[model samples]
Target: MAETSEARASASAPGGDAGGEDDKHDERMLECNICLDTARDAVVSMCGHLFCWPCLHQWLETRPSRQVCPVCKAAISRDKVIPLYGRGNTKQEDPRNKVPPRPAGQRTEPENTSGFPGFGFGEGFHMSFGIGAFPFGVFTSTFNFGDPRPSAAPRGTAQYDEEQFLSKIFLWVAILFVLWLIFA
Candidate 1:
């Protein structure tokens, strides 16, 4: 037992060439099972196999009915795989295109328990009504009065442009209606 322990210590000494070679071997172990190349977008299965996310995604897509690790045949899915982050990785590539993005790490804040001491139930309740005939109702409908409407879409988006165009059309229609009411 003493001789075996001494032999193990000598083999793993910090300054040995064998130690450097062991590092290279460890790196090789991280290579993707499917591509037989160093994994990019690395993810590890629950069964303890490493893979590139894109390669695994394609594999899973190809065999939708049987999602399993290529190496161990253990049950695997996108959510089941844990992403591996390394110090050498620096470039931030967009994960959104063509493939599902890696899951973001979840964070949760502690709940706030303090009650609203100054506020009453009446403050939460708001009710309003409008009583008028057809013309008045049309004018009121033209302008939203109570319960603030949602803000317009952010600028430079398709939804914003469509909303702007629709608002202009409605404005013109409202003007025409008001003019017709006055003249007739």
Candidate 2:
């Protein structure tokens, strides 16, 4: 279970998905709206949203006076929320497997801001409420962003040379394929 959580965290990290931007949509669909991580104990809101049960429950609990869907502000409640069960579970599984994991507690942000302005981390106004998720994810991947990736190797390095060579080889293969199509 710890291994699965660790894998999910790393997959959600900057430069994690090796397949590039195409995988973004796939990943985004399964992520919890509040936690902004892969959905564990996943549930779908009636308004058509994906969220982790704990995150959704915490959000709903925090705003009891206004029990609406976190993603779409539609009507929602503890009873209204449906739990998702994975087909991976087998009838012959271990005893520990029968019990569900405990819910994750919500983190309340401090009043004082540090990294970016206008983003009220204090008011539970996360950047991933839908719009800012792309830019935030992209900027944070590199360019002085929080989770900075390591710098590329210098020009004379063998690693750099190998990468360039591989790119050229792929380019030639692509060109040959295109030419074959044109001539055929």
Best by TM-score: 1
Cα TM-score per model: 0.41, 0.38
Q: Rate the local accuracy (lDDT) of all candidates.
A: 0.70, 0.61
Q: What would the per-residue lDDT of candidate 2 be over residues 1-184, giving only the tens digit for each residue?
A: 5576566667768876666445666766778898888887777877778777777767777887789997778999765766666687454333223335436668988788557564332322222122346445433322221222255445687756764565466556556755786799
* Model 1: worst 10 consecutive residues (lDDT sum): 121-130
TM-score of 2: 0.38
Candidate 2 segments exceeding 4 Å error = 1-19, 90-184
lDDT string for model 1 (1-184, tens) is 4565456667767776786557657867988899877888888889999888889889988887799889888888877888776887675543223386545657999898666553332222222333589677656655542335455456797766765576566568778988998999
Error of 2 at 92 (Å): 12
